[model samples]
Target: MNTILNFMKRNYKILVAILCLSVVFFAFNSNAKKDNDPERDKLLLELLTFVIEKGHYSPAAIDDAFSKGVYKDYIQALDPSKRFFLQSDIDEFSKYETRLDDDLLSKDLTFFNLTYDRLMLRMAEGKKVYKAILSKPFDYSIDENFNTDYDKAPYTATAAELKDRWRKQIKLSTLSSLTDRLKIQETKAKGTEETSEVKSDSLEMDLLDKAKSDKGVENSAPKTFEELEKETRVSAEKSLDEYFGFMNDLDKNDWFSVYINSITSRFDPHTNYFAPEEKERFDVSISGKLEGIGARLQKKNDYTEISDLISGGPAWRGKQLESGDLIMKVAQGNGEPVDVVGMRLDDVVKKIKGPKGSEVRLTVKKVDGTIKIISIIRDIVEIEETYAKSSVVEKNGFKYGVIYLPKFYIDFDDKGGRDAGKDIALEVERLKAANVDGIVLDVRDDGGGSLSTVVDIAGLFIQEGPIVQIKSAGRKKEVLYDRDKKIEWKGPLVIMVNSFSASASEILAAAIQDYKRGIIIGSKQTYGKGTVQNVIDLNQFVRNSAMGDMGALKTTTQKFYRINGGSTQLEGVRSDVVMPDRYAYLKMGERDVENAMPWDKIDAADYTIWNDNAKFKQAIANSKMRISQNDQFKLIEDNAKWIDSRSEDNTYSLNIDKFKTAQSSIEEKAKKYKPIYEYKNSLKFNSLPNEIDALNKDAILKEKRERWHESLAKDIYVEEALNVLDDLQSKAVTTKAMPVKIKKGKLAKS
Candidate 1:
């Protein structure tokens, strides 16, 4: 024993050395870099060890997949929406030294299998708990304590009759997603059907006859598919009102979407998920080739209301279509209309949308209480609407150049080609060539596109300076400056914007306003979304994998701001000239979204301001007089009231006496409008395109519009803006004011 102990002691130093060496070797083998992030590497190692021990094994055997494979798992865990971890995307992400996805990549099968299993188990448990709670009690206090009262005093969906309904409802919703692990397309139908059958039993026609009756589709009455559909839609829309609550139907496909979305959001607000349709439509929409009614429509529950009229579109051309009108029925030309009141918004849109020049008639319940057949010829609206259109407006005595910048235009297909900035430069050249005193840039509902175009547009007005700044994750903000000393159109500028102007539009408007280059007039604030999203087609990444192509994803990448920091997420841009709009009664603009990116001002950049804006103000004040007294402005205001009465919503009492009284009031207003031609063309929802022309008495219409535009020259807001521009040119001072508020900004743009 002594001899053995002596030998052991003698070799103890060597043995310890060997043990230390082994430890060092393993550490080196698993060492992640420390130049940027050391803590991340340590967590990754721990996760690797944890995963290898208990992760489920696939028949294919991913026990010791490559570190690259492991990395993918971590990425997916971080963003399970499958946003960044595309197979093709891996190649690009791999190029980065320390990918953000490293923490998300998984090293073993145990992690994936175990997590998936646990996830399913948890989901089942959740449903069980929800079912149990819902079955146990009924209370009216649910609205007050739903946020905190899941336990103890839960609200129940459980009357004997309600129990069966609750079960079915839970079955469809909770189980619809469970039938598949994720929200993926269940069937591709092999191929498209050459001819789809439309039954002569019109779903739309029957609903309309019912709607015009008393007690308009009550709760107990929602027995049919259509009725239930309407109720579901109504429920979905209810969340949109007051304070936005509840997850969107798309996000509720499965538990994973909810889980992944929350997890990744902790790291940064930009990253998010994309459903299959979101990905598909991402390309189709921007490409501008998708079959749509050529109008900007939005779903607000069972009601799909017109968000914006795609200017010069068939709906706009039909002239009867107005924002806030609810589409009730859809019919192909001369066919009986289908009441799509309770249908999915997208499905209804599909029903209404078709190939360009084809006719789709909408049974529109105008906000003013009139139900009319407004037929429109769906035409491919030109991209010009998304660009800057130049017009010469003489407000009061000053003839100012008016350029309507609909949105910050960008063509992604041309990213590798021509930049939209150059196009804007050309448009500016047109305005400059027109040489009409000062300029008024009207950007009412422009939502922004293309960073390069935004930068380029800003540069066109200013000689050159920092247009914007981008701050990457945990990195110092880098300024993107316009060093080019070229000015496309540097005349006194007046920028007209509404609550809907956002992103690139906000950047441009803010920059111009900040630089003292122009005045912004319109809404109280703009849609303050100053973030950027990158289109990620997951199919590109997983093309060779089992899923083939999952679809596309437009993931938020980063927030953009003026050279001086100010993210316009919840707070949109404020206008310089105020105008009254009927929509103001509703909660409008940003700051309405829950947890929208907060507004903060950063350090201001240095720039030179030309002190020559007095004349623009002088001209504006002078124009206001003409506008205030102008016959056209008076007529327009009167028409707004007259139109408002006709478009009155829900107040339509289906009572015979009320219906006739309302009809008489509508006819009276239509006659008193003073324009003889307005009455000649009766706007009915005709499915026939050839018949649409009769709605407008062309020559008289042109004469009236020209007269209207001439009157518009004297419009209080337009005239004031032009006068402001003239005053600026003459070196005048006009205090800024607000304009109309657009309500969509208050809710999730999803």
Candidate 2:
């Protein structure tokens, strides 16, 4: 389910492009094939390949080289951990390594079929091996280690070797569970006067014997190693069961998606293919509103389990549906109940979600082992919970505003729909009414949304200017501009971004930096996704086709550049005040993505730099000095370095005693970093007076605001941003206002 969701998220721009592009009708074969048929898949492949070749901005040639790339990606996608397939399987599949392009061109599935069949066989073998390994108790006293870095590990060469690998994997999983349980027990036993004096070797035997007894075991003694082992085995079994169940649920379309993505991704990372169901999921994510029981569902051991309940949603209001509850069956109003056990999570969701005000019944098994039928009236679950929101932060008698934009979200189909720009403008107005001294625009972890919305938001800062330059293959560069001359906020501005901030986020930040409108702060660079994608409906491309709702194809149509000529492609927007972040040393950008478009530049768009640019140099210097002297900043740097070092150490001891000792040592070391979490800014944040009435009326809104304020008080990044804003504000007040001038040459420096 997570894999499918990730596929939708990465391919979201395709749905956006689908709405933006005018649907052009083309001739299609009337008698192609029915849905779910192999012929339909072949037709889909042909259509997808044709679309990529003709529509993609930088389509790779369909040659042996491309085929090899696809083959490697496809294999990796199939078994990324290199656990399911063996070296021999890879060797066998290598015959079609450079022949995939030929097969795709001919719409042949011979390679796909062979690989699929092999995967099924390997998975069955894996299930047997895991079950056989877990059937008996594991000896945690063995001195062995397991390397979790699967990329560096070689595939097993024999069945015995594969079983051994599975055994070690199972042991590692079980050891983690055992250690966690032991810690919990130790914590619980801390205040107790009586303590068990059971030896490590005899603990399992005693626990096994106690298990054979009655209720006296719980009250008479603490749990032994045998009980913990039993519990861990049960959990491991359930996990494996759920995994294989999910794997079994994958139809040809699922596998086809993997293959199609491999091909599309060769052109660029953003280009993708979305099945019809996947497109719906993308819409739900973007719209942030769905008519349903708003409970996050996950597949757990052949049952649809409620993982989380959205705050203020229907499920939350019901109070009966809780996390970890297993959904047994789903039924419509006054209808016969349909068992949902073993059903696909998407199918279960479809059964549960209905029109607003509609009733859906769910027979759920609670985590406490009680079963009940709970009926919930479905309402519009406002994913407004995921939208842009703001809070007023007060520091040193100055009230500053922090607006966190999760994405540049917009419903392209609905002009009057919720927009990030409008929401942000409203937030700015609310902050202005409260008389904020400055504002921090937080775009951290925002992967970006609508391009038009980003332009509108950028316009709110600057009076009027070109925001970004876009260029398609063999086409003249088109510069997107802020036509509106009205400035929404003239006070000091700070835009906060991180490694996850990409595309539209980069555009907004770059435009602000290019014009010296605001100080961009955070990690060294953003996600650096500069390309634009357009999702074209395959059905529209092939008119009157019997293939039945051919999924959309998202193709990279253009590449966007900052107004200052530099493309935010592999090289994302650089921050003015660089700070050490967890991802600072991590390879997590467009450059890290496979086949990401190379960075380049074009002529700078005609724009004038803000007259306040002179203040940035000194302000940046002051910020650097403060960060260098601050204890919190020092702790953050140390923590980031420690995390990076830990990330490099993938090998883990399998022995229970050694594993526990290692975990304890790490925990002891982690205690020193606890000060990082305890570090709190002196800033006091609050909701605007105008919003107080609304917030008071809406309990969920009030709760969200309180949570946001609490988080802001602890956020070191926002504190630093506020400090930057302070310096900018003070500089503005001390220095004389410079006359606005239009510079014709190079862009301003940060």
Candidate 3:
């Protein structure tokens, strides 16, 4: 979801120069003498404001307009559902709306203090309101409605009105759950097996044997409507209790982070502050590796529940820890087990996550009501989904390769480690080894990562050329070029993109399109994010600071443009062959943001458009004509329109009969589009020889590849991309150049 700048060497030098000047100024003035929470907070505000003002690519003027934007965004973020603060609280808070800019300039904390304390009070009151409403039986016969359009709904004026609002909301939830349970019971009574897709929490749990063993399977037997109704209320109450428990785990710093982000985001959607823990998570996300047991945990009231295990990690390989298992105690090797039942989830994670090769034992309560201890040797686990993977498919007696790059991943710490560029080159080499006729590089849902990787990847298809242009404020534009003259694959190439493809993804797609080296296919346009960001460590500016881990700031430092001199800021790359998308009617691109940067153009870079493919234009025309007459695609277009029409239907009834009737009508119409998910392209996707050998040894990897290949078989978009590749096939033998050296100076296709 972010782009890394290639000017790290220069960027850090610039930061050091500005930060030293700020440090000298801070030494002369002493506003908050004491080293307390408030003092550290004030220092953070000072450092954050100064860094962004000096470092941001296009720093917005900190005027009344900016203040108002922060005020609205912060208030909305605090109470997005409008279930906490009453109208009076908002009225009082609105007085300082335009004065936040002045307060920020003066380093004042009046507005933040007042709002944070008031939010705390309101949340305590909200806990009571929900508890009181769920304490008794709800009257399903009552004719009432609840609108989920919270943005447009007015806040309640009084406590009584707010209480009534809670009542109707809870009533609608219980009524819906009650009806689903009733249907399941009816199906059971008719000697028919109940469907696993029921909406009731307790009923859904019944499908798992673990639930039957722990909660008693007898509970799933046909129950009276009264019994089901009461259970619904209990389930609703338990969910609220768990939610409040999670909220209570958040200390003052967590809320302060939220408040800080509201201000930072006003400059741009991609710019924000990251706390210490959040920064660590961001690093893991981009690098796709972490040293731990590699299991995701969730806080369920008192116990830490194992949500899912990373496929190739220690826990997954151990084959002991399971999804429903609850960790009761954690202990280091040969150390006494420490109780983690009532501990915060973060604290539990801190206990479990350790250096690589360390041993940790966990005493877990199995779902079958048995207590057992399991030991695991922690190691560096690579998230398989984050890397690029390729699958080969046979179409019309020719082999085609499909490579899906989830993100442009890179390990900033270890330059020699795996990255998107290195992995993609290896995938291309593997596909070439398999004698593939064409290749489809799918970048769908890829939000983007390292900017340098885009250049390296785009270089694989073409000889030497500029891939993208980057511009800094008040500076000349710099064109990033691939100097390597060797091409790995000289076959038909197609780049697939959608609305979610952004930043680095856009840069790659735009370069390929401008070069005429590949045909762009998928959604009408991409996510329209053309900005570059650099994460600055705040601790580097402060000397002898008592505040532990000052965290980091990711800010927009530049904007990238296509080699054709066009900015993908607002108008992302338009697909050569457009496809229908379900969320097309929604405002989802960078242009949808209120304060997004405007689009502009620069001088085009000197590059030659590839003219080797003779049937490139004919392939595009053939695919467009085929899509126009396809029945499945027409049905997809109709479904997209139908989905858009239903976006505004947010209100639901509390009356049981009315609610059920309305839901039935919607479900009946939805059944007509069910075939969309079931549609298969009848293509067989397979792994290359190397991957097949690895998959045979690793069962987990085998299952993952099987699932991925199955998904590719059903993807109609991929089917079309393959069709385009088929049409682009040339009788003229392509001049396959020698493979160039990849990242880390290793020749992958030598």
Candidate 4:
């Protein structure tokens, strides 16, 4: 989701000069009485359009086609479920569809102003509709069905029709919850405490509790069907109330961001406008670190509640701050406490977060109803989930290392800070020290980050080579290379990817595949995001203006390609060994995106393939043969086909009996694939010595690692990856009967 570019240093002067020259004709008048600053909005529109037009890799013409695309996307984003806007409202909005291009050019806010005002009005009416619909109990005996295909569903013509639509929506939700609750009761009556459905429901409820901090139904005693049905209504009402509460918190600025994004995304799917707060969040996500107390807060009605704590955060270590606790006030150091109750969530967060080593004191009402003040020293909290983690597993008399990179993270401001490339190199060193026979680099769901990190990570497996090719608009392709001669991992290497793997992930996979340095496994192809984006801070362009923050823009500035000349754009790197995925047929990749950049090829980079991996071809053949004959894999393929067929099965019966029967049939059919989750391998995974030491100190960290290791034990794909690694081992090395030298416990240098 992030890309490498030091635009602040390299392109700042040019951008500012461009903005200064372009803004001479743009005149704005302030309206202090307006809800949103009209002058600021106009300036922002002017700045955004000029910046994108000049910087984008291939900017789309701001013509009628672009205007139409923006109109469709914006309207859909505003009311995706088609519950807020009426057909009459859409008819009125359609008048300006093609005229939006003129609005953008002249910085006219006519379309945006009309739509924003209308949406606010409609949303206010929608709040009334849903509340009234949920107020009355839905009759489950009615022989009716509801279609969840909101995209095709026509907007209601009148208030009466809208109410009926809302009723069906609410009824369907409550009916599903009612069925789940009734099933739990039935299972309890049957004395079946360990049913998979029960376990799944329990997990779902537990997750909801953590997310909402909602005190769920009181006691575990079995309830009558009537009581369960009422509970379902209460749950649905509470969920809708919370959703509307969040909607109420959004201001005109937030809506304006959406409107801006609708315009930006017309250039490409990845191009987006980030508000100031959103920009901060994007930075945290890319860096995987933040300067805060390390506790996540959510608005619960009028109170700000602690939802979760980062594992290694100051609040977590303090132990006084806990999830479900409500914050009443926040004070910086010994300053006077500010009442944060009923305040905006963003304002509350601003009050709570401070620079590292600063102290923030919070007055909180505990879950037990006792009030207490807890002072926490804010520090740099690294999100463990963002970093690459490895587990050493013993399989077939050899230790194989599995390293999972959640994303290609990097701290752009800090050159010495942790990045995917460096962390991966450290993991390789650790695995080598553990005497691992081979390594599996898992980037299954990695959406990618720093472009530089991809080169660094890919370089670890090869001695020296051109990693990837990059091409900007109207420019010659530039080849990025790994000039380093030291290969951190020269032994058996396998890179695991899925359809979610994208951008820098595709680059790494394609590079390794091109060099024949490692085998690429899993998914038919990756997420197919080949374009690179750079975040442009808009505040830098304006000088000393009272317009406040202008936020930032992330736009596609270049396209990346594999060393073999082909762009990974829509045709993401094809796997060397394809695996059956349940969601394989889902239209979730970049290729499915309507406005995605087209795929094209360039001249190949000059590089020699790694000739040392003699068993690579045989290993791939052996894996294919094993997977072809495996019953589990065959079942997985069948499940995939079943899932693809069921993708359109979005309608459900409203009658209680019919719903139960349909669900029961599904549960029975799902039982056939139960082996997928239950299957466990003989291999046992363990943490490295350093992680083991840290795990012993942190119970939360220990639990996370244990769960991950357990999941790895149940992963058939990982087991197959190990099988490939087994086949990939050099035969001559094994025949020599040479003992791997060990210095005490760690493996000696090869």
lDDT of each: 0.49, 0.81, 0.87, 0.86
- The residue-by-residue lDDT of candidate 3 on 85-143, one tens digit each, is 89999999999999999988888888888988998898899999998888788888878
Pitting candidate 1 against candidate 2, the one with the higher TM-score is 2
Lowest lDDT block of 10, candidate 2: 1-10
Tell me which of candidates 2 and 4 scores higher on TM-score: 4
- The best candidate by lDDT is 3
Ranking by lDDT: 3, 4, 2, 1
With a 3 Å backbone cut-off (N, CA, C), the pairs that clash in candidate 4 are none
Q: Per-residue CA lDDT of candidate 4, range 657-695, in tens?
A: 999899888888988988887899888899999898899
lDDT by residue (497-559, candidate 2, tens digit) is 999898889999999998889999999999888888765667755545566877787788778
lDDT score, candidate 4, position 26: 62
lDDT, candidate 1, at 586 = 47
RMSD of each: 20.0, 5.5, 4.6, 5.5
lDDT of 1: 0.49
* Segments of candidate 1 deviating more than 4 angstroms: 1-156, 159-272, 287-384, 395-398, 415-420, 540-543, 580-588, 614-716, 729-750
Q: List candidate 3 segments past 4 Å from native.
A: 27-36, 190-221, 334-336, 732-750
Number of clashing pairs, model 1?
61
Q: For each candidate, what TM-score against the reference?
A: 0.47, 0.89, 0.94, 0.94
lDDT of 1 by residue, 601-695 (tens): 55555555434444545555555565567555456557666556544342332233343355446555666645522222111111122213632
Candidate 4 regions exceeding 4 Å error are 6-16, 23-35, 198-221, 731-750
Report the error of model 2 at residue 143, Å.
2.2
